[model samples]
Target chain A: SQTIHQWPATLVQPVGSPLSLECTVEGTSNPNLYWYRQAAGRGLQLLFYSVGIGQISSEVPQNLSASRPQDRQFILSSKKLLLSDSGFYLCAWNGGTANTEAFFGQGTRLTVV
Target chain B: AQSVSQHNHHVILSEAASLELGCNYSYGGTVNLFWYVQYPGQHLQLLLKYFSGDPLVKGIKGFEAEFIKSKFSFNLRKPSVQWSDTAEYFCAVSSSGNTPLVFGKGTRLSVIA
Candidate 1:
């Protein structure tokens, strides 16, 4: 079975601080990875997705960025966090094909004060 | 660009009540639809999906949805909902093949026992 791991599960950081959230998949290779943010009482917003290593497609323009360093390792980063950047961040993976379902990791709740 | 619309932002129901959540999409081409559920403090999980063939798709925990292409709608249903059915439900759409999904503002279902 494939599993996705994301950390830290919760974080509290001051405004303008650097941020790094990691996600990794095990038992799968060349999977499609995605980053999503869910604001309180709002729908999820796709932040970034990667088809392969070093290939990232951003869905929206925001203060965050994503990277795929390895086949199953994805990272979401920001040079400086904004108050608006605070949300529940989720990492998901899917089979690299059409009509496939996505699997999600336990989301990270980031609070930017 | 693909976009999804979920009609209700929040719903409150009692046990054994029939449930329906409306979802619509705006994309003129081939599309895939999905329903995901998020339990409190847990990761998002796939409830069901529709890609091709049958438009009526059944998901876990007695949930089902129908994809009416003519109306560009995919609405989730349940004949009888339980207290455990209380959760956030999200509707998503992806265009054609190998595309990132677009999500709607989720519907928060609160089923009282």
Candidate 2:
């Protein structure tokens, strides 16, 4: 069974501080990974997605960036966080095939004070 | 730009009441549709999806949705919702295979006991 893990279930950081969130998938190889953020009372917003290691596509323009260091590891980082960055961050993956169902992680809630 | 729209922003319903949430997408191409739910203090979970073949698709927790191509809509329905159904619902769409998903603003459903 494939499972996704995200670290730091919740975080409280001051504005302008650096931010880092990690996600890794188990029991799968060469899967497409994604990063999403959900604002309060809003839906999921796609931030970045990677087809493989070192290859990333950003959906929305922001201070966030993503990296795939290993086959099943993904990292979301920001040099300086803003209040608008406070939200629920989710990690997801798909089989990279047509119309394949995407699975989601438990998500990390970040609050920028 | 591709986008998803959920008609309802917030809804309050009693237990055993019928549930219907409207979703529409703006993309003139083959698309994959999805419905996701987020409980209080929980991550987003897949409730149902529609790729092709059948217009009416069933999902977990006794939820279903019908895709109307002519209307560019995929509305979610549940005959009788329980109090546990109180959560936020999101509608999403993907235009191409292996592409990123675009989500709506989401509908907040509060089912009373």
Q: Residue B91, candidate 2: how far off, in angstroms?
A: 1.1
TM-scores for the candidates: 0.97, 0.94
As a whole number from 0 to 100, the lDDT of residue B27 in candidate 2 is 89
RMSD for each model, in Å, please? 1.1, 1.5
Off by over 4 Å in 1: none
- Model 1 C-alpha lDDT per residue in residues B25-111, reported as the tens digit of each score: 999889989999989877789999999889999998899999999999999999999999999999998886678878899999999
lDDT of 2 by residue, A37-58 (tens): 8886677888999888898999
DockQ for all models, in order? 0.75, 0.64
| TM-score of model number 2 | 0.94
Backbone clashes, candidate 1: 0
lDDT tens string, model 1, A1-113?
99999999999999999999999999999999999999866789899999899999998898999999899999999999999998999999998875788898898999999
What are the per-residue Cα lDDT tens digits for candidate 2 across B1-113?
68999989999999999999999999889999999998998777899999989999999999999999999999999999999999999998887766777789999999998
Chain A accuracy as TM-score for every candidate: 0.97, 0.95
